[model samples]
Target chain A: MAQTNLLSPPSTISPPTALQLSQKAPRIIANPPTSSLPWPLSLLFSAETPEAWVTHENALYACLRTHDDAAARQLLDRLSARFGESNERIITLRGIYEEATAKNNGELEVVFKKYEDILKQDPTNFGVRKRRVAVLKSLGRTSDAITALTMLVESSPTDLEAWAELGEMYAKVGEWARAIWCAEEVLLVMPNSWSAHAHLATLHYLSTQSSPHLAPLNLSLKNFARSIELNDSYLRGYYGLKLVCQKLIPLLSESSSVSKRNQDEDGPPPNLETVKKLEELATSKLAEIVRRYQPGTKEWQGYDGAEVIAARELLNRDANTER
Target chain B: MTLLQTAPKKQTLAQIRQQRSLVRGINLRTNANTLSPSSFQARKAYMVSAYQEGKFLADPEGRGKPRPNPMSDPAAMEGMMGMMKGNMAMMVPQTLIMGWINAFFSGFVIMKLPFPLTPQFKSMLQSGVGTRDLDVRWVSSLSWYFLTLFGLQPVYNFILGSNNAANQVTQQMGQVNPGAGLMGPEQDPDKLFLNEAENLEVLEHRWILDGVEDRLLARTAG
Candidate 1:
């Protein structure tokens, strides 16, 4: 009227429809209310929305940070119903399930079964097999443990950890040959693996003692030396080598003496250098054994440990005699 | 025109060698006896008795009972004594010979006897009898079994004191080979304290299957 033109009065503009209002409408209905969720749905729906999903995620995270598993699970469940079991929800739920099982206060088999079902469906999802293998080992199903480890080794042959695990499983079952093979496989992958050499050395020593041959002894000695070379702190391998050398050296010394006595018509004692090398090996290995496994603490207690004590006693006597 | 006394031909080395050959056959027979199972058991029993029990057999029953002295047969005894005295005389030192000669010359004569002073020495030489002393045999057998279990068979084998490992090694020789064997899982000492350690809750109501109690805690706290 003032303009008298009625210029269509700016033609009464209509507000945009709800669907046309925000592209984040789906994000709004799915979020829960928590301290972590700082934004209201109405605010989230407004034109000036400041990251609704992130704000809600932070709120839920804060509740979990406070050790509120119930509140956390509640929010997670509510979100899962809306969002379905996403990877994040699966992981968090699995953590809660494992914690419950570990406490012995909950039904473990049922939860583990559920976890297995999930893993069966996904298969390559995360490190589920490793976790399952660990759980099986804890349950004392050694055969099953071995089978699981076999599968892991087959699937992940290049995985050093998997190789170690397979070796350990074989060792636990008294499959020395297989254990040594697995350990050597690991050594192939990780050339300087002290543990692998230790495993091989132990197998050689135990399995060879009943035989008339020296090949087993030689191989065992080599692996023991290799293990010591890799890690001098591995007292078990060092002492084990010493124990073997203790038995072998006397036999070799006797053989050498016999050879020397027989050599009146010969050029030289048969492989005299071999005897010298064995003696040198024994000396060094015994030294390593003493350095690594000295008996102040009860660390050396059982037969193997007691052998270390015996070695020390013998060495001390030798030193005294030398003085 | 004296009756021709034929010069006794000196026994040549070949004839002496022939005579020595007879003793080798006796040695072979003794060696065969030593290889018998009873001989092995006797040796093992002896070793165990000597080393572990601090006992030695003065007269083991398995050994045959000794005969009474051959010296009781004076003709045979005199012949044996003459042989011994003749051998002793040649090898004996002059000073030792004089002492012996003086002793023999005097009334305190040291006469050589055909039989040994040790009674039934040959009879005591018989190897193990199948059955005799129950307690001694039982203890020996029991100790042998236990020591094998404790891995003493190797030491016994090395000393050539026992034959138990013989059959065992032969039986396993086909399958036995060298390599590291599987080891049993090493139990961590820390595992013993696991039950004693208080459970540290990473999340509560994790025990509650349904979120009902977890929600309740929140509601109660709120």
Candidate 2:
């Protein structure tokens, strides 16, 4: 959890302002407690690096993570002050603050009502609209959230973030086809995004898993390969390919035993030799990445934490079985 | 500088898109006689056009015709001097008054500056004033003139517009970087579009998604 990017290595005092140096003053660090400082006083003590306005959201999220309501409230207050109370961004941040700090569902519903009122007054407020979807999801109204997101995408189809969110929402409710469609729409907007290709592959894999009979694995494998081809540094694409190939090797070895085999007399599109080649390709690529970028190194640190761990585990499993 | 080397031209996003459509049209026309669905589908004209057009926008300055040197031409030099007159106007007035005031005042009043200066500066600044001793650390009115000359940037900016004459640093910088002015000149859009169109013919598209699904299932179910 990137609670706050402002936190530095402890010995390296970040900015080393007056408060951070003195022993007598209550200095703030990475994660401050809920009631550590009063809203007005906290501003003087806590120092986030002056980044672009968007990074303030990271700070706000960080405050929420630590359950530091006073700091979160102060941060939101600062944002609202900077970009007036009537600003769409301020309204969304306020909603997020309310949602985060709320003790019960009643409070959440109240926040939901606030969003609805804001949206009703000015419908083009997309920031508030997105926040409303989040609130709806939080309120356990998935269908409503889906409808809202669908409407959002229809109006602004090129909004890649909205498409990605819609994809996840669809996947959550077990609507694989629609999820795939969402992925496709995202691709339509940004065809060259390697992450999008990897994500589409994952959706295809999930689609196959959801079906009673096996869907074509070719699409999934091809997407994974395409993702890797587009971006050589794509760790997720390699990891997905490795996992798919591991599952695939067994299916190819025992194709007769599987009920839903391909009916083409061309006797499988890739054939057995090609599957082994891909399996080797994934394994070698993954091994090279794991070997080259050792854990805690800058290169390794660029990879996702879970993906790195998963890749390490996969390699270890292979090593153990070989032994 | 290398006469043997050839650099590709750079085109904008709009130029690239226009070239792609033109190439698509060319592909359709060239193979009009052999326009079977199967033969037509063999080459994805759109994809081939898209990834190639404007692949090299702003590649290198030297293509064929040598770039013009402003200093070599007398007319261009005079035009530049004319343009520079406004910037010099504010600086000239301030510099003249400040120098005169400094020369008049420092003849008698040998004032100590708020900050200390090195011994070397004392010779330069305290040239006409009193202090032949170690007390040469004192600053003359000449030092103040130098300080105000550079430091009055914010004051001038507040008085006149921001892009006004007080800031010589910014003005000199704008001079060094060509085409930094608001209404300097624009690149030829027609030339850029045509360059991009020429680049499109030799480009090829490799579709990674083609037969991908089939390959994945073939491996698994085999």
Candidate 3:
């Protein structure tokens, strides 16, 4: 159990405030702001020893861990100022994280520019690239995110995560075939990738456009089931399996009825109406799975939990209309 | 042979399960480092907490990772032994009461003191005589008939059980299996055992239980 300290902050125990510490700092080498600095140099301060820098890093990490936004913001401010405005990529990224979560669009735009600058300087920083992808996706720049991720995938085929991200971006943009292809690519690299299988299943089961996709849907469900076989706690794979199963149920029902007639009938032509209904039902079920595992109220903090709940509601509305 | 040397001790199932749980947790944290920053942070915090709690030794700047040895830290070994001793001490009261109760119910009696007695005295006297006469005689007969049962039995069992538990903990450590717990069903028993063997060199150095630790480990293998 965590011990809670109820005492007041210690009085008269003054740690050097930022201004006092900065006064003892060395002069900055007057270089153009656009020039790329060694990544670590961008983290320097006037009199701060490596030990103090480490302590600051540890403090920032602790704030992030405990979900203390205010402390995290203060640390980010200090780091950004020390590194100078143009080169504080990490600090700027932290700012973006803070702003994105807070839904401060103006703040998000400011920090996003910094991220863009970081990417321009070194596009291969996979960590920054992934975070940038998330920011872009959240900001509704789906096309741009996809282009960036596509480039990332071309360069790093071994990174299944990049493939997964591309697959998700494709889905957001309604490029179902590309999404399926990306998901499949991930499974090729990591045969037991539950997320990839889940994405593929979602695309096939939820899309109403074609019949060729159903084969991959079955395959995706099987992969998902295999992932579940490996780790039962994988709620994502379970949600995917549930969506596929919901879709399969109606198709199976239609087939069983047709089989009784003993007639060579091409399966009931895709009824757009029924297909749309199945899509809504599958989507709703996926949301319900997420909601059941959603962490409680105070800990909610604008998480996947809310997105999951909203997605479920959207599916329910669609399903209700179809019914 | 002495009581401790008489039989090769075995690891109990509960000890195995507990160790597996801890090892599995450590593995989950290790593997989480690859996919998520949150997991990396959590693992770092967990390590820090374990160090603070004295469950693990402090990590020096560059002198290799601190391996937990049950034997090297005399204080830790003493603490575990102390717990076993405390548990053994508890058995004394349990046995004494159980022995007295068994004797009373078995229709044994001391010399009947035939004098008119108060009801209170009668009950108290009956209990005392029952314990002394019935228990003492029954125990004497039992010692001759079933010679193996002794006071040291509980103590030895506690020692072996605790040692087995500690060994299992060493097996489930984070350094041993980095991603074991996240997907429990996928965990490899053979791999876990192999890792445990590799860790044993360090584990043995911290042997918490004097002679019984290895003996119990061998029995557990069986």
Question: What are the runs in model 1 whose C-alpha is more than 4 Å off?
Answer: A1-100, A103-106, A209-213, A231-237, A250-323, B1-222
Native contact recovery (fnat) for each candidate is 0.00, 0.10, 0.00
- List of chain A TM-scores, every candidate: 0.54, 0.76, 0.50
Q: What digit string (tens of lDDT, one per residue) describes model 3 on residues A45-64?
A: 22435455444444454454
Highest TM-score: give the candidate number: 2
Model 3 chain A weakest 10-residue run by lDDT: A4-13
Task: Count backbone clashes in candidate 1.
Answer: 10
Write model 1 residue lDDT over B82-104, tens digit each, in one string. 44543443335435644654444
Best by lDDT: 2
Q: For model 1, how does the per-residue alpha-carbon lDDT over A1-323 read when each residue is reduced to its tens digit?
A: 12211122222212222112222223433544323434444333433223443433333443434444454455555555644564644554444435433545245555567558866665544356666676677667778878977776544444567768877888777776777666655554555566666777787677666663354555565566556655644555556665566556665566765654544311232243443444455456566556755554444232255566776776676578669
Cα lDDT over the full model 1? 0.45
Tell me the TM-score of model 3: 0.35
Q: What is the lDDT of residue A155 in candidate 3?
A: 47
Highest-scoring model, DockQ: 2
Q: Against the true two-chain complex, what DockQ does each candidate achieve?
A: 0.00, 0.06, 0.01
> Considering summed lDDT, which 10 consecutive residues are worst modelled in model 3 chain B?
B204-213
